[model samples]
Target: MTDVPFTRTETPVLEPITMINAFTVPVEESERFLRRWKSNAEIMAGKPGFVRARLHQSLINGAELRYVNVAHWESGAQLEEAQKDPEWYANTLQMLNDPELHIQARPSIYEVVVEVEPGARLLP
Candidate 1:
């Protein structure tokens, strides 16, 4: 994906929605889980409407979820359509269905209701 300039100076269009996914995985299974997730992420990164994505790992070892993924898309429809590709779907399903890797995923979509721009507003 081309790097888009981060120079917009507007109220920030809310066209691109966000997808948040949390993953619960045991420490021992983290390697396997991450490998599968990486594969899936690479495929998704090449899809249309895929603006950007980041995966964050908890600093605390005992955090409930090991990883949280935040992805931005032009729209939910486009994101959904991107994942519907036959090959992508099959690959994703294979990872999900793997018995050895019991990864739990909680995914949700959200629209931006508020935002704090950098150095844009004075401290309250």
Candidate 2:
């Protein structure tokens, strides 16, 4: 992905969509779970209504925000349909319910109403 600006046309699609933000625990457990999560792409491939999913890690002030997993879909129905899959549910539950991973976070689906793309900055 490029550090590009979101113009008018590119902004609208993101606005009406629902954004899911997932925060994981520290790397010790979070990283391990993440590795497992990514390794099983085959499971996700068969899930219904799976549009796209991406993982993110905090940089500077990250402890307050450990990891972020973003998934975008055509609609909530499609996403929900995928979740109904037994394999998807089992794999997800295993990673999430791991005793070693003491994850503390809340993920909420939001309807994006507006967006503003920031311009280049002097600081990186």
Candidate 3:
């Protein structure tokens, strides 16, 4: 096969902020936690810099961590702004103060180094 030269197009890269939250919830209270979590997600989705949010549940029958939340924001400042909102604060406090659910959240922020798209060629 002969190599053909193709013009490469470069698009602006986005350095969006990412938040990962690991949650350990009691098996029996998983549904209730999901409901509350969804409501919280909706509130975040309405924020200015919010990109998207996803919640993942462990498929293992007896895993230590029950759920993991991954959310994307335009920047860390935007995430902080969302957290400062009254509704967001209230919902967070409610989740933290709830006794029946026994929910624990371990949250952290991250920055992307590189991203590859399917069917896209990498140019040197």
Q: Which residue pairs show backbone clashes in model 2?
A: none
Candidate 3 per-residue lDDT, tens place, 1-124, comes to: 0122211122123457788888888899988888889888888999988999989999984777889999988877778767777887677667666666777777778777778899877786
- 50 Cα displacement, candidate 1 (Å): 0.6
* C-alpha TM-scores of all predictions: 0.79, 0.66, 0.78
- lDDT tens readout by residue for model 1, 18-79: 88888887778888888988898899999988999999988887888999999999977777
Worst 10 residues of 1 by lDDT: 1-10
Candidate 1 versus the native: TM-score? 0.79
lDDT accuracy of residue 23 in candidate 3: 88
Q: State the lDDT of candidate 2 residue by residue for 63-109, as single tens digits.
A: 76677777666666655555556776666566656667666545555
Candidate that beats the other on lDDT, 1 or 2, i.e. the better one: 1
